[model samples]
Target: MNLSVSLASGEPIYQQIKEQIKRQILSGELREGELLPSIRHLAADLNISVITTKRAYDELEQEGLVASVAGKGTFVTEKNKEAIREVKLRQLEEQVRSLAAESRMLGLSKQDVIGLFDLFFGEGRH
Candidate 1:
């Protein structure tokens, strides 16, 4: 797994790790049942504290996106079907909300804004 954490980022290291891992899982970059790096390994790779990596993994397990097994390492959960759908929907909602605010500031009508959405989404199907 490729992971990076920016010390200069405004977000905390644990949060950055958590969000990036979540994004990777949601984007299908990390397959279901895929084994994650050991917490110590990941911490060494990122040059961060083991507790930070553990915190991120803890959050992922709580979100049902991953699971920890006895003696074995952490693995991406196979039960993410509904969780994935919800995550994608929330992402779409945030995108639409930002676009709506931008469109309003640009003095676009509702129909015009929706048409723009159709244009964007329609092209994405190709």
Candidate 2:
């Protein structure tokens, strides 16, 4: 698994790590039952505190994306498929809502937004 933390981002580092891992899982880049790097190892690799990595992993476990096995390590959970899909869809909807609000605040009409979207995405569609 590959992850990059943006120290420049105002969001907390742990949150950045969590979101990136979640995105990877949702994108199928990380499969069910995949073993995650140990918290200490990941911390070392990222040059961050172990506690921070542990917090991210803990939140992931709470979200059912990963589970820990005694004496072994944490592995991506199979049951996260549906939950992850729901989470991603909700996140996308929230982003669209924010963008729509911003467009309105900027005095852009609905048609303007639609036109921009089409200009960017139309060629990719069949």
Candidate 3:
């Protein structure tokens, strides 16, 4: 599990860890049943406290993104596609909201925004 935290990002280290792991799971980089690195190992590798790492893992577990075994370790759970889709959709919606606000401030019309969106995606550009 490759992860990093930036002290300057203004987010808590545990939240950073949780978000990174969630991204990996959602992106399918970490498959279901794949064992995560031990908490102690991850803490050592990241130079973070074991408590921080455990908190991240615990949140992920509570969110149904992972499961912890008593004798083994944490493992990614079978992802719920609807849940994943909802997450991505919410992010996109927020982006659109910001775009709409900025567009209105710039005196751009709805058609103008649509044209730009079409121009970008219609040309196969991400």
TM-score, per-candidate, Cα-based: 0.91, 0.83, 0.86
Q: Candidates sorted by lDDT, descending order?
A: 3, 2, 1
lDDT of 1 by residue, 10-103 (tens): 8999999989999998888999999999999999999999999999999999989999997899999996588789878998999989988998
Error of 1 at 83 (Å): 1.4
Model 3 spans with C-alpha error above 4 angstroms: 123-126
User: Candidate 2: where are CA atoms >4 Å away?
Assistant: 111-126
Clashes of 2: 0
Residues 1-126, candidate 2: write the lDDT tens digits. 999898889999999999999888888899999999999999999999999999999999999999999889999999655787789789989999999999999999999999998899867678
* Candidate topping lDDT: 3
Q: Write the per-residue lDDT of candidate 3 for residues 1-126, one digit (tens) a residue.
A: 799999899999999999999999988899999999999999999999999999999999998899999999999988888877887898799999999999999999999999998888767545
Candidate 2 residue pairs that clash = none
**Each model's lDDT:** 0.91, 0.92, 0.93
Listed per candidate, the RMSD to the true structure in angstroms reads 1.5, 2.3, 2.3
Assess the local accuracy of residue 113 in candidate 3 as a C-alpha lDDT between 0 and 100: 95
Error at 52, model 3, angstroms: 1.1
